[model samples]
Target: MKKFKKFLIWLVGIILVVLIAGAAYLHFSAYQPSTAANQAVKVAAEDNQETFFKAKQNKLTVIFYPGALVTPNSYAIWAKKVAQAGYTVKIVHFPLNMAFFKVKAADKVVNSNENYVVGGHSLGGAMAARYAHQSDNPHLKGIFFLGAYPDEKGRLDQKKLDVLSITASRDGVLNWSKYRQGKKYLPKTTEYYQIKGGNHGGFGSYGQQKGDRKATISNGRQQTIIAKKLIAWLRKIK
Candidate 1:
């Protein structure tokens, strides 16, 4: 009987060691980037033209939200360009950096508007999708996704109706693997724009910062070029 107890104790100790090791692996793994190893590149200042084509006489309004765990300042430059195009663009400030709650704030900020569009980066994009998915907001024109993916729970269904999905060719952050998931919610009518030298966090104000993470391109000129393209796309629909 004593022998059996000792053997059982030994077995328990072995199981415990394995469990601890597995947990350590998972914890460390989560800290690693989802993409390849590259230096965090700094982006350039915004020098795009101030010309903005007004889509509507009253002026089209857009609610812009940032990505998860990202600050609103990162996309400041992009917002300025969008707003410069004769559209009133509102960049959401998520105190918690959580897109879900941040989107709720956007709805309230945009309490009432005859013509309004919603869009964001990464998780922010998903938040916009959820907002437009609801049938109540008929004025919600559409959404733009920048290196953003839809949640597995069907919140990204808006892409099927009126959505624009843009991805940077060199962006490892939102690589093809991560982008493929968005396809399920994309409609045949949805438009796709591929930014040649863009990265996951390229378009925003972070353009000139090395940032806490690595980026695809650090060239200010290239980022500005793509920013111009993004503005052009917004104007095309205008």
Candidate 2:
């Protein structure tokens, strides 16, 4: 018993050390928002601090999460366009820019009385799916993913929620095998779309990622497609 306890303690200690070291590395190496992109935008929140793009008059809201190590501002430019299309868009900024730190962070931004959908980009998308599947919030009408998918344990196969998944044709950064495996976790009504010639990093304003392929389309062009898809999806749900 003593030997087993000691081994367990050592194992936990090693895991914590690795997590801390990885977080520290991400803190310094995280991708920053492009300076060329507009930095000024409307900020609105009841309790949570976030970047919000609110339509003058709107009923439904779409809460977005940033990808791991990505700045919330990276998504601001395109979010404004989506907001202009009608629905309110709120981008949640997570601690260390990692949604894994707070999978339920959207809870603070969500207004249960109002209609809403949740989605995220990359790691953020995966976490958003987990939040949508785990929460009993009836107002959560649907979810969307940008180069992301749900995890095995966070499956939404039995849920009635609408799901949309957006992927890039030239996205080398996404794990194709894992994404394929994750489809079994989505609901039967999930919709999938791909942006031709776009790379993974084009989903946000951030410059090229280390492993991502060079995008054939400009970032603005790719983001426009993403905004169109989101706007269309929101219209369908409402």
lDDT of 1 by residue, 1-238 (tens): 9999999999999999999997566444322211211121112121121112232333666677677666554554445445555666566665455567645555665646456667777778877776666636666666777777665553555443456777766665664675786677756576788767666666554432223234455545444664565566556554
Using TM-score as the measure, the top candidate is 2
Note the Cα lDDT for every prediction shown: 0.58, 0.87
Off by over 4 Å in 1: 1-58, 152-161, 207-219, 222-227, 236-238
TM-scores, all models, native as reference: 0.65, 0.87
What's model 1's overall lDDT?
A: 0.58
Worst 10 residues of 2 by lDDT: 40-49
Model 2 regions lying over 4 Å from their true place: 1-24, 39-48
Worst 10 residues of 1 by lDDT: 33-42
lDDT of 2 at 198: 95
